[model samples]
Target: MSEAEAVIRNQSGYINHTAKKDYGPLEFTGRIAGGLRLDLRRRLPLYASDWTDAFKAENFQKSLSSILYLFIAALAPAITFGSRFLDGTNGQFGVLEMIMSTAVSGVIFSTFAGQPLSILGATGPFLAYTLVVYDMAVGADVEFMPFYFWVCMWCSLFTILVAVFDLCALMKHVTMFSEDIFAGLISLIFIIDGVRPIIENFSENKMSLTSAMFEALLFMYTFGLATYLSHFRRTPWLLRPIRNLMANFAVTISLVTASALAAIYSSDTNLRMLSVDADFSPNLVLSDGSKRPWVVNPMGIERSFPAWAIAYAILPAIGFAVLGYLDQNLTSVIVNRFVRGALTLPVCAVLGLPLSVASTVPSITHVISLTTYEVKQLPEGERKVPSKVVEQRATNFLIHVLIGCALFLAPALKFLPRAVLQGVFFYMGIASLTGNNLFDRLFLWLIWDPAKYPQYHYIQKLPIRRVHLYTLVQVVCLGILYGLKAIKETSVVFPFFMASLAIIRKAMRFLFTQEELELLDSLPAEEEDGKGLSPEQPDLVNLEKSKENDEGEPAKATMGV
Candidate 1:
């Protein structure tokens, strides 16, 4: 048996205790139905304990650092992307609405959410769906805001129903294959969107080709440098803490550096800057002084609500809820390393979805939503040690609420160069893609040295051809989703496309073995083991084996047969 299996077989008692003490009813193998019985009395202690542990004196610095990192990573990109759905002429929701909704959602979710560490924000699929809705409303000659309001209401209600009824429990069948494909698609969107503008502008102005190329180069350089610096831990002269700090703040550093370079070299060029207005208002009013209410009332529209329209609205609402639930939970799985949990809520992209549905009340004690795109093993004397950083979800999200207050600072927002934000998005996209195991395995064979290639559990256990076949399936799914997104009319169905992935996952079980599927879906052994031990504990099995060898005894069973 593999070391992991052996550990599981031998550690049942420990697992039981850990499950009871540290895991929630819906987390791991605990009963999903039992989560519904959870109340404030049981949940409050977990929150309070986590809050207290998160705010301890020694952890204060890390919490503050997380606030800075998450703000830059989440907020600026949010404003940039969210602005795409705004149509001032048609009175659609604008950046301010996006910010307000996200902030309110963050605060509300942080308070009552299940997975405290899952960061909720505007996503590309949702943004695309919203844009589609705007087009549909305009095409039908209906007021966009009113139509959107009703759609959002329906979507939110659907999400709540899904959460209440525990429909997300069905998501267990979705393997990493589907999750990775979804995440990869979103990452590619960010990268393409970031690069597309520069390419388009270059094509439009022949005379400015030189300047545009220079601008593009500058953006690329800035993005590359920041990415490099973020993971640059090899500076022997620098202290470990300083290296960690640099890695932590890499995205922000890249954005500032790129912006400064653009300002110095390409200020006169057609490169765009963030267009936040100097005069700001939290109240709902378009730039043209059209009154837009903060709360959307479906009945307030000029046109009568037809039954067909209501029926049509329900499909998209279900689609949106499914998309939101998938995006939020998939991100949580990637971040928290929990595979078998159900999301208990609906998500509205325009309003910004809450994090995950799985109440992480039990696991919140270790860390909040702070997650990295990469997990690197750093050398610590004789063994490599995994880094553990707390996400400080409550504190960081509260900081996001504070950053939302900056929406009124039009001048400051405008000063944030659009290229810099693009660079940030590009960095995020590249980081996400590179971090994905599927992405890695897809190109694994291209490596010149097989010995140097990563030996993940899937690669070790599954035949090479099977690995390639799995990747091909994911690519085809990605292409279909991308194709759907390419057409404006079909873009609104993007959420439904995501929902289809679950169905696709179920069908794939017929093609692959249960053992292969389990390996593909399972969390990494290191992550699984790390969860059960305190940071200070050594790897006892490895230590014992080493001692046995040193004493010249017959080697005990090891991982390899």
Candidate 2:
């Protein structure tokens, strides 16, 4: 058994993760052009097929369900981030801009991009950048919008150059190590934001204990019920069709049920409701406190504002571009399993919308909602492996269309309680962490008994100590990113800090062997039937048989089989 274990540990590197392509370096224009040509060559063939596959009869139900799931998933963040923008930009941008940006960018990306599954919305880093830029404008005593306009123009220009130069190919250096850390940061942010309300409510002592507890209960109900229903497909209680329906519309069902209860008991509960603008209009407040027009006038500025400031805008734009490119491409790589195109940042600037970058948690949620899985009986129990993804544009198109339609539904949305939405945020944060490998490794720290370990591919291939070390490194990096986020002055360089994760991951090569790094840092590989079961199953079976022999009875055990 010991010999077998050693062999498995030494030889099982590639089993757990997908192989990353080494793009080397694009040292010259020739290489850049070639990369771009290759990208176009691969993508152009799929364009027509992408559209045709979107509207199939069988796709409608799944797409419809995804629309509902993604709408709330996307909306909570849009509104949350929009509120932050309002405070940070002093009402120059708010929920209206976020909604419009998400609605417009989402529709366009779904219809035109090579990959439609990756959702684009306002992100925390971009919000941080906006806040920092606003502070800079204030310090200069200049008009905010005009300075913002030049920054956007320059940022957009840089983003275009990135795409044109095929710079996204550099994402090859970003292994699962950095990806998981980045993902964990985003997930933690969602969780923190969700929990913030409860902290504030209790800390302020504004509400009675009963009312506070009642509000907290509503929050828990939305999160708890939604989470439970999402996993209903795995339960044995219901028929397959019913379980599927419940699972697909889990979030929607939970939100509606919770919101209804909150509304009915609103007078008794006195819970805070979603605050929305009275009308669907521009959120940008002018110098005299009047709302600006829908379009941001690029030329509007203080008389003393210098033309030199326009060129100076490139300094900040560099950071925004790097952040935008990384945000857009990293999520794109994860969603598509290959890098896809992104040029929406420029449009965001033109429209005075929040820079629409790929939102990690929401994008992950969208992909998971559309994915199909198959349950196979293993030695221990039934396990679901991804079978196919419903990669259609119709779902995305309709999702944003609903968001656009939501603009006019302000009256209807007003009654929805903040607690319910925060519950969704909590659920999203928790859900996003579910399949993450970093979380998987960190979970091992609590297992004191080595025998209790699940036979995950990584566990079977590497020492527990080494796995913990890798996880610790990731945690340290995440802490740094979080720290950068916490400090306002440092937040302007937030994207640059995020980009540094790739460098941090590269430094891991000195501490671990090449094979060990593969198991620890690579993306999970797909399970195929003829590929002789996953690396964990055979070991699980052998362990079960060994236990049976040792005890002279049937082994009642399955360890992540």
Clashes of 1: 6
lDDT of 1 by residue, 322-438 (tens): 776676554343212121122222223333222223211112312322321122233432322234445334574565577577567656555555556666667656655644666
Candidate 1 RMSD to the real structure = 9.4
Candidate 2 residue pairs in clash (backbone atoms < 3 Å)? none
- Residue 241 CA error for candidate 1 (Å)? 4.0
Where does candidate 1 have its weakest 10-residue lDDT segment?
Answer: 552-561
The best candidate in terms of TM-score: 2
TM-score of each: 0.74, 0.77
* CA lDDT, every model vs. true structure: 0.54, 0.66
lDDT of 1 at 70: 57
| Alpha-carbon runs more than 4 Å astray in model 2 | 1-34, 45-49, 56-90, 127-144, 204-214, 237-239, 268-271, 287-289, 301-315, 331-343, 360-395, 523-561
Error of 1 at 116 (Å): 3.0
**lDDT digits (tens) for residues 224-325 of candidate 2:** 998888666557876756765576566677878998998788888778776566677667655686776666667763344578777777777888877776
* RMSD vs true structure, all candidates: 9.4, 9.9
